[model samples]
Target: MAQRADISVTWERWQATPDGQTARLFHLTNRRGTRLTVSDWGATLTSFKLAMPNDNLRQLVLGCDTLEDYLQSPYLGATVGRYANRIRGAKFSVDGQQYKLIANEGENCLHGGEIGFAHQLWDAEIIESIPAVRFTLHSPDGDEGFPGNAIVTVTYTLSEDNNIRIDYEATVDKACPFNLTNHSYFNLDGVAGDVGNHVAQINANQYLPVDSESLPDGSPVSVEQTAFDFRTAKAFNQDWRKIVSDQRYRGFDHCFILDQNDGSQPVAQVRSGDEQVVLSLYTTSPAVQLYTGQYLEGTRGHNELVYQNRDGFCLETQYMPDQPNSDCAEECIVRPERPFKHSTTFAFHC
Candidate 1:
């Protein structure tokens, strides 16, 4: 049986310095009888068990089994940084100098390269008043081939409003492009089944067109009558299979240009049945990457459960993918002055 949740919580010394690296785990619970388990190692949200309708509870996020999983999970539930998505050719001309990065995603530099924030150990602080856990990681100058000594802070604030707000703030000492996003593949149906029936709505009238490598090939085209439209709420599998022929994604990974943003407002919404978990993404960034995990089959885990495609989805808020050398020909690269910062609220309703 699952351990019964207690309103009172305690912090156990759960394997700090597991990989000869310092990290800590904190268990937080409020008076309402809900519980959240978090770890500073990769700043990953391990689990969120909340009370659901019919007096039942559920874990609404797809997570890993161990600390090592958090260290090597494609980017699961971690705050991905520096450059969140792919950069074409693993090279970008920054400040008149062509800077090269480690290419981990085939020919592209993906998710800050092979060793990103998701694999780093972070500094943790539990603020009692804020009733939240804040994880901090300092990315050294040129850590991921991106300039600047960036000091980043990711705060997981679980409010009484039943909102999990992930707030990011980063300031670089040098002029280098910075973009951050959370790679939490949410399965609001409680991490137990495929989310194909889940409904989603993005305020996007158009989406950036990409190539076979999942890299932007050109500008975004209008979704007016196309199948890329998500202007209204629609089922996940409705057009995804048809879109597989797009070749750009080869599946369901594309950046949607949101229509309902003044550059600072709610841009997308995701809902699940049985739990009614509503995820609203609000960002000051230009684009958001919507990826339906068509390749996340559970493989070689302790349970031997194969994670097939489309079990979860990711709504990564960022500038754009492969924008470093885009220059309007491909993607839009964000300048240095603007350090990436955005807030996404995951709310639940019974």
Candidate 2:
């Protein structure tokens, strides 16, 4: 552990990857005593402990105990890419050329297919000035059936103001759909249980409805007077029964269109069930996917806790799902002329 002023960074050898590469865990602490643990393997966030008023550290995100545990986890606090979300039919066209990707989901390419960025080991570098850790990866052309030789970087910075800023940047030699996000499940109460009682609000007037397979069914629909409406602060489970009633959908797993992309103001906010902590999310992404972890039943997590459905929730900030097959495909494609860059910040308050 090394300290400079009020910020500090510590690390330890975590575990070895399947290829015999050793992975390490980097811990960054801010002035307020907030701690964030990340690993070179998958560039994943293993834990986030927020300094509480009672002098007890509260873990806000769902994590695993070891690298093997994360291998079985569902994108838990991991950086997901070549493209986040799904690409319909496991195929798309780029420059009049049809490209068929590796299908991981049923007839769909999910989170960049079976071996996505989430499962790869990244090169980690500690930035002492900002008290940050930057993880970088190189994806060769045709890797995962994508047409691009790309260099991607994800930096996690713990600022003095209790903010975890995630900056993502990528450069591709060939044009390809590029979307990235951190899949961190947050439980503001810092416990393993449903987030039904958490008060939440989103700055989105419209959302994309999904089909039986959880893919976009049609165009964006108005959220007015619907269970998807979160324009005002309300309990996450206020309309819980309405969702569970429909077997096709278990809970909130749809993507909401953001009203702004400036990142100057918070696009969403959620207060803990106990009303002790609040998290404000600011992003430059065009959409935020709210997943209630409906499929997390029987999964084991940190501290040997067996997680049930809705044990945590994820707000994945990125472009809309299935964008590569939609009319807006061009808008998400990354070319040499237009490199990809975006940022999302999670600010904590107690």
| Top-lDDT structure, candidate number | 2
Ten consecutive residues with minimal summed lDDT in candidate 1?
Answer: 1-10
Tens-digit lDDT track of model 1 for 1-350: 33233333356655545568656667777555456777787777767777765666677667776666555556777778678888888888866777888888887888888888878888888766566788888988778687768888988876554566778778777766667888877778876567877888888877988777888877888878766788888877788777666433334689997765444557888888543777676766667888887767652222334456667788887777876666641233333466556666666565
Q: Candidate 1: global Cα-lDDT? A: 0.72
User: In model 1, which runs have C-alpha deviations exceeding 4 angstroms?
Assistant: 1-10, 16-19, 246-251, 262-265, 299-306, 328-339
Model 1 residue 114 distance off true place after TM-score fit, in angstroms: 0.9
Error of 2 at 209 (Å): 0.5
**In the order shown, what is each candidate's alpha-carbon RMSD?**
4.5, 1.7
Candidate-wise lDDT, in order: 0.72, 0.91
